[model samples]
Target: MVHPDKASTDRTCSCRINTNYIPLKLLYLFFIGGQSCATTYRSLFMRHLGMSTQQTGVIWAFERVVSVIIPPFIGALSDKSRHPKAVLITLFLVGAVTLSSMYFVPQEESLNLTNSNVSASENVTAATHVDIEEYGQTFWLLVVLVFASSFSVVGIYPVLESTVLGVLGPQNRYKFGHQRLWASVGYGGAALIVGYLKDRSAESIGDMTGTNRAFLSMFAGVMVCYCCAAIVSAKLPVRVKRDHEGFRFQDLKIFLKKPDACAFLGLLFFYGIDSAILEIYLFWLAEVKFETPSFILGASTFIGAALDIPFCLAAGYLTKRFGHKTLLCFGLGVMALRTFLSAIVVNAWQLVATESLRGITWGLMFVVICSYTSKLSPKGLEASCMGIMQAFLFGIAYSVGALAGGAIFNLMGGEFLFILCGSATFVATVAFGMFSFLVKKKPYEMKDPGDCTSSLAFGKEVAESSADVL
Candidate 1:
């Protein structure tokens, strides 16, 4: 019984909402579902695969090396082609395939060669057999797959951030925090689910075989999530303006001229080192030192991620009121305090308690740094600027940090490692706070003035202005 005119108006409104609102909501869902599969289970999977602490560090270092080399090229390609959504979908598909391959790699069987009455010749034979079977084809295949998947997947965040920034603009940049809170929810929920599954499996089948099987299943689930992410990414609206300007080498030089940008990058580098150490070693600390159950280990992550939800949801409002620089310094300071507290933990529960600080530190740091980077970027080169920032933070800084932290852990144990990283983070926080004093803030204009309907009059004025300039 609706009138034709009313029906037509309703349809138009629906289209506008679909075009504007749904796409961003889907991006938020993408973060939630995608991170649940990737970050929540990756370290646990590697540990289940029997990688030692040092060996795990080497693999992560190599992965970061790939992250360093690939993201910049991908960023530039996204800018020049103006098809970032397509690029993101392609990367997700490739990453899914590579990640799935890891689960199928065969596990090497351990050899027990000890015997009281074995002859020298028999001992030699056993030694040769053990050497041949240990770390064979399957082990190296997993390493290669990890590197390949990491290279494909690591560029995702910067591109996604660029797309979000394009849609939100500088004035509405605070909304980015609330959007990212969904990712925290996804990560926490996924960790809890995976943890419960692993615990049940272990109870039914015993720890060794059960945990390994659970790890394989987790990787399989990650593949499915990545596929879903690819589908969602395809639907994302593209708004970044594409010009014939192509990629310019000078675009890279723009950040160099700004001292504030340089200082921010430096702070990111040191903090990257601190974060890398924690990511690589935290579970190892819990498992080896505290002898925590696998489910409890996962619960700790869940708790930390859950804490992030509220902080991230409020980050935009806080940033707007207190300023990005203040938040940045505050986040780094929290990290320093968290690291110092983590160094003194005597029990698994205490470690979990310290992890609650992650909400204030990591959740706040990522949102603010990303929004601030977008604010600082030139009008057209947003993706490239983010890419460069990530390259510095996740690439060079992460690699050095992982390698050095591994070596330090091997030589000096966890106490010294924590102390060292905590001290360095504290120093960086102080430096960044001091550097902020020299940088002047500029007011941002949110409205576009070029949307007049008198095209003929605008065209005539443009032609006359061009002739005068000539």
Candidate 2:
């Protein structure tokens, strides 16, 4: 028979683990799953609606511009707010509605064209006028919807990361990979399922065009997943440990003074540019060059995401063994190779093989960057740090990539664009290594006595504060 105290201890430990892991797992699974359901196919949907690649790029770049302006403020707000979870849930709901609504916008070909008793030239002119008006309206509407969705989704991402880090506390941060791997599972699985369904005949899905109806079906899945995610967001243990010295916007300057920190941020910006180009144009390349099927494209993504599971699980170990600076170089080196391979791949299967290297570049890199950012974060200002990171990675850099990549792809072609990106990444990786070697490490001296270390205390404080609120 087990000793009574020991048994109680075991039970308590199990409960604590469950309380921390289960809700976050479900939140990631459903939230990312919902996003993947639509995100993987969004570009295709825009293309199907008669939008040119440049037009699509313009829309994406515009949204990234908004992300630049909004996410940091939202992160600051979350840090200051007593009820950050409520704000996150509200963002989720808004993002879900706006993103899903994009699918239901009337297709360009569906515009009314019937006109009786007109000369041929007159009719042609009238048709051109109607087409221009409709195209402009549709384009602007899609842009608005995309902006709204991006504002909520991008703004919430860093805050969500802060919540996860806060809940896990500093000691258990190594397990972040385990938590993040669930997002890959959700992404890969959703892509696989939706792709399979999308590949089905039009007759089976009750529409003459398989792609259009498939996206409509995806809208329903997004709503269900988002609703579930919002419900579970309430369960997240987000405690705001009120610091006597409140986080000021200017406090970030002190944190940025470290040479290594500045290098990392610069790396992220350039890395963002290369990654955005791939994200925006890779599938389009596969489709246009090799006539890749929807299911094959999905399979490619599934394969890459599946690799993320293993890579993410290994991230902490890799960082522990090689250190963050080494791993950053390694990840960038891998990205350069991947981009170079993308330029030369002649077949869809080869494209998939090359893309699967994202396990290292995207998956491992994400974990490393997030962990590094967390490590560098000042006490009581974790959200602000993550927000700035997101702004650099996804907002400003992504916008530049989208706009520049589109122009490059139009002028020089996709293969040439990838080659240029790959070469630039390789050069950046080398430059970063040289910079890190030259720059001396600065000792972090806190300007204020109110500050503390990176370690976060969670659980009981959260429970007590939540109870008081309730």
**Which parts of model 2 are misplaced by more than 4 Å?**
1-17, 109-135, 201-211, 244-247, 440-470
* Among all candidates shown, the one with the greatest TM-score: 2
> What is the C-alpha lDDT profile of model 1 across 4-72, one tens digit per residue?
999888655533322453466566565556556665556556656555445556777878877876777
lDDT of 2 at 158: 69
lDDT of 2 at 263: 85
Task: State TM-scores per candidate.
Answer: 0.81, 0.83
Residue 450 of model 2, lDDT score: 16
lDDT of 2 by residue, 117-208 (tens): 76755654454445444556657889889988887878778677777767766555556666888788888888777777776733476644
User: How good is model 1 by TM-score?
Assistant: 0.81
Report every candidate's CA lDDT. 0.70, 0.74
Stretches of candidate 1 above 4 Å error? 1-19, 108-139, 169-171, 207-211, 244-247, 438-470
Q: Let me know the TM-score candidate 2 reaches against the reference structure.
A: 0.83
Residue 350 lDDT (model 1): 85
